[model samples]
Target chain A: MVDVNMTLEMVQASQVGMKAIGAGIAVGLTGIGAGVAEMAIGSAAVGATAENKDVFGLVLLLTVIPETIVIFGLVVGLLLLF
Target chain B: MLKPEQMSRLLIVASKDQMAPVVTELYRHNLFHIEDYVEAGAEGYEGFKIGSPLPGATEASGDLVKIRAIENAFSIRSEDFEVKQRRKQSGLQVLIEHELPAIEQEVEGLTVNRSKLETKLKEYEQKIAELTPFTGIPGDLDLYRGYSRLVVFAGYVEKEVSLSVPHEMFFSKGKGRHFTVVIAAVEQRSVVEGALQEAGYQAVPIPDESGVPQERISFYSSQITLIKKEIEDINQKLDAIKEKHADFLVACEEILKVQVDQTEAPLRFATTNETFVAEGWVPTNRVDAVSDSLTNVTGGKIFITVLPIDLEHDVVPVEYDNPSFAKPTQMLMDVYSRPKYAELDPTLILSIMFPLFFGLILGDVGYGLLLLGMCLVLRKYLKVDDGAQLLTVLRNASFSSILFGLLYSEFLGFELPWKPIMFSRHLKIGGGEAGGQGPAIPELMMLAIWIGILHITLGRILGMINHARQDHGDHRIKAVMANFGWLAVMWGLLIVIWTIAALPLMPDLTSLPKIFINLNAAAIVGAVLLVTGVILIARDSALEIVELPTIISHVLSYARIVAVGLSSVAIAMVVNFIAIGMLISPQLEHITVVGVLFIIMGVVVFLIGHALNMALGILGGGLHSIRLHYVEFFTKFYKGGGKKYSPFGYKRRFTED
Candidate 1:
């Protein structure tokens, strides 16, 4: 097996930063995607919940389901760096 | 039980002699939800018209309408003043006999007087403006009005135009603010008008009055003062009437309403001169008690029959009977839908599962306490009635969150000092605290997938039970197979994923050949079950293929359960990092002016940052869990188009039976 110090020296600091950068982009873009999906769903959800209080829980659920996109991105991001 | 309470139709027949006693007894029992029987298609009975209202209903309705009008005229608000404790029959009789007629007359007089005063006040105000401009005129307005030949243009003009107009025209200085002037008939009247137009002349329309401008000014000024006093007097009278009758007017309207409803009760039945018949629905479990009570009340003279027959096509009212602890979960189902009479009620399952997911996302003790405290404050101190359902959901969610908080050993993104009831969140996976390590991201993803597996399986199980409940003959094999197939395919997918993710664990899997073979076997198992479930659900069409991608996405959706919690913790940790940075800032090395400024800024940042994090935590944690139920969980088993139960009985306020 190669020495741990030698292996660490072989990897460039900039290349390590690049992985971190990729993870950030993955998370950031997913955030924008989640926000867009929430905007469209949220408007209808709010209107329905206003008409009847009963629809509030369902509306809240529908409004946040798109959040999974960001979580997927977070997983991808975490995998990249860690 | 995960189903609405069972119900059956009821019919009661009472002779004219027993109708009063029967109606009274039914009112006391509060059992029937009356179905108004209109003889729309009774072929033999064209003479059987809908039942008419009992005696005095007309009078009661008239009194009610009058009370309403008085209340409106007086602008009476029920909550404006304290009302009498309860509205008794005697109280209503006294109000109708003594107070209503007097209140009606007084309100009428006050309204007429107020309107007259209002009109006079407007007239006086208009005259005051008109006469003020004319007061400076040398001659009376009447003197100007009598002119037959004079080209009288009397109005204000701009400063520039007043100078340029013909000198022979009446040049007396009027109100200088606008340079008011009267252009009498000049020799060149046309040319003069052209000059006036160029000068921006605004002609004042003269009112037909008998007196001079100065006299009229004084006359209007005095008139306005008198009218102001009169209007004030009218206002005072109306206010006094309101003060005296505000409470009484509110009570009077309520009494008349109850009287009207009681008198109009017979209109729901089919009545002949000799007999009355009415139909309604009652909960099956309470039918024996209701029947017994009605018989005893009417001395068994009137027949009360419980019809046990079931009509599958008829729309039946649905009544939910959830235990008190599970009532909040019913609020979630109510917003989505009311279950059909024959389908399952998902509230109890929802109660257990919804908060579990919520608490999983929260996973922080400090924020849980904050949320719980906020809900308690809102529910107890605020006493707001609207959105009580939402508040109940928040309270339940926070309770679960506190439970999870202890398990995760997190206190506002900080690790607890003592032993946790379970593992810490920091040990789970991914970034959370400022300086903490965790298991691989893949591990968390797997946990999310497992949760999805269980949630979806439970949904299918419930769906299977719902179908079985509605089935009459031997269990409908196709429906059962479809539900059973869903369960099989989900498990198949779960095992396949678990097997692949754990492939490296097979003791130095330098043997790539064995890994490939294991994956192949798992894939085959998943594929065969998937196809079987598809065939069961969609035997006639290729449309079933569309659900495969949906199934995959639905499982992935559970990833949010982990994702939202991670973000919430990240935000909290970030806030703490910033706050601590300020407290121990490098700028604080010499205690300079800038250092003190930075400390203050940091304190503000810390408070605002944590406050924002806590708010988002509640929304993200509470809502995402609820989403798992409605979107991922409920579609599996629930069919919701049940008619809501609204009994034909008044909810009395300020009255009791």
Candidate 2:
């Protein structure tokens, strides 16, 4: 019975470890995802700027929407670390 | 190839005498105007207007004299003298004719001003180009340094004194063996060579061969840049002036609109009532709202009517009213509607089946969840119209995917640690047990077949209802007989087949004479009733001989459900095989990095490929499902030959006609 309890605890620990690893992976990939997302928006914003300078605010707002996903992932990772 | 058949009920009220008042009223309504008039007959009894107001005109009438007043109180004049009479009494002809030349002259003057403005814009662009050195440096740099042995870097020059000193000095250290200098820049070369020889004693003279000119090529690039800035400032001033001119352009357009309205009003009154009556076509569903608006506008003076537009008949009858719904009810209705006749709606069976199939093909809870989330996000925020509509459809699909995901017991291509919902508990089973222990193939197959049967039965029921509503006595009878009687027969056949197959294994049940007697009696009764129903249905139709073939084909259409379900399962199997094979490879085991990469790639490929396949399959299957309803089911009972409604109003396409 003691052995069973030890094995169960070990499995639980391993599960937590696996979850931690997944969290790290999610955070590490998020930067690359954000960069890719911003590349298209940045180029589009530059093009729009050439036509009308007033579009800068709007372009900036739209470009930042995708970055929030990465930030959320980071927050989750940080919470897990603590 | 159907020609539009003209309605025989129309009547024209515009005689030569009536044309004057009609034209005046039309102009008063600001519906149309006449621009230019030409006499057609010797008596000037017939004439054509060159320019008329386009359709969709809406404005208050101008202060032109009434044509009706002139006709009512005018002296007798020769046909040729009609213009003089019109000018003398009505004065409207004079006002209309006078306004034309003045507006034209104003427009011509504005055109000239616009050209001048355009030229000023071009001049400003040239000035801006000249002001910036960043734009001019690259082109000029090549011209100044081409083939010159003397190198200049940040105002420092390196000049060659002798040809015999080997061309290595021109290039940076270590790269000299690859580079050979063909030209040298030198001033008083013999003196420089003597000094060099005194220092090293190996210097020799060769002809001065540098391509660079002796005098510096000076140009006022900076001055040009300043001038360009000044021009840009001038352009800003010009832009302000042009904005003011735009108001004048708007005013001129308004004047032109008035003039065109005056010209065409007479023609519109004379022609539209006779040629094409006042009519507007709107979406069938929006008819009530449009009619209410029309009634409110005219204070119930104008008549509002409806007609269902039949594509097959090419006829729009005068009395068919459509039901109001924001979305089309049937999957087929979306495609068959007036605006989207070319696109086929995939909402029918495909709507439900596609997501189910996709869930089966994908069989991964994690991927399904991802797809659902993505679809939801796109639907909520994206400005794309079709994509948003598709997301709404995918919402329904996601539910089916979730259901399938649970059944497959997969989460991101891995079996979940927790027990699956379908099985009560985990069985100690392998693939060899009953061929594959996950799900019984016979059970799944039976489910697919049953689904097909139910779908076909529903379609037949709908057909019978539609036919009954039409009140076509014989046709209604036929629809009922074929739909219900055949279903009964099919059920009886299934029972007999099942009993016969099971009898050998159950001797006690088989030996009972009562079971056989009941089965034979039921089968005979069902067969007789079905044959009678078919004969009854065929009694009134000309192609009664072909009724059996038609009925059989209709029944066979339901088989698609089973076929589509099986294909979904097959696709899932293939995806699983590829993912599992890649994961378990011996070489891949040692190469952890490659193995991880392969797993990720496999998961990604599986997710995308299966999802796309599911989406497309759903669309195709949905369309086929709707087709089954429209052709097989609806044909059994419905006769949709109703006409659409149209009312008199400003057309949508032209703002001012």
Q: Score the docking of each candidate (DockQ).
A: 0.33, 0.02
Candidate 2 stretches with Cα past 4 Å from truth are A1-82, B1-332, B336-367, B377-388, B407-436, B471-519, B540-563, B566-570, B573-577, B584-657
Docking class of 1: acceptable
| Model 2 per-residue lDDT tens digits across residues B1-657 | 011122222222333334333333433333221212333442322443322344433322332222212212222112212111111212333434465345434444544555665566566455443333223122233433444455321111133334453332332212212111222344434553453444333312221222221111222344445655665654554454444333332323333344445444443332322231222344444446555544454445444455344444333332211222212233223223221221122234434554554444444465567667877887767545455655665665566656766775655434566555542111222332211344433334345445545655665565555445433556667656655654554554444444445422222222224434465544455456666555554554536545455444444444444334334444544555555554434336576877778877777767765776565545544444444444554444333323333332222111122
Q: Categorize the docking of model 2.
A: incorrect
Scored by TM-score, the top model is: 1
Worst 10 residues of 1 chain B by lDDT: B503-512
Candidate 2, TM-score vs. the true structure? 0.43
Model 1, B203-309: lDDT tens per residue? Answer: 77776676786777778778878978887887788889888867666777777776777678888888777888878888888778878877887788777887665
> Chain A of candidate 2 scores what in TM-score?
0.69
lDDT by residue (A1-82, candidate 2, tens digit) is 2355568778888778877997797777876898899999989988987897555445554565455456445545544643
| Sliding window of 10 residues with minimal summed lDDT for model 2 chain B | B77-86
Task: Name the best candidate (by lDDT).
Answer: 1
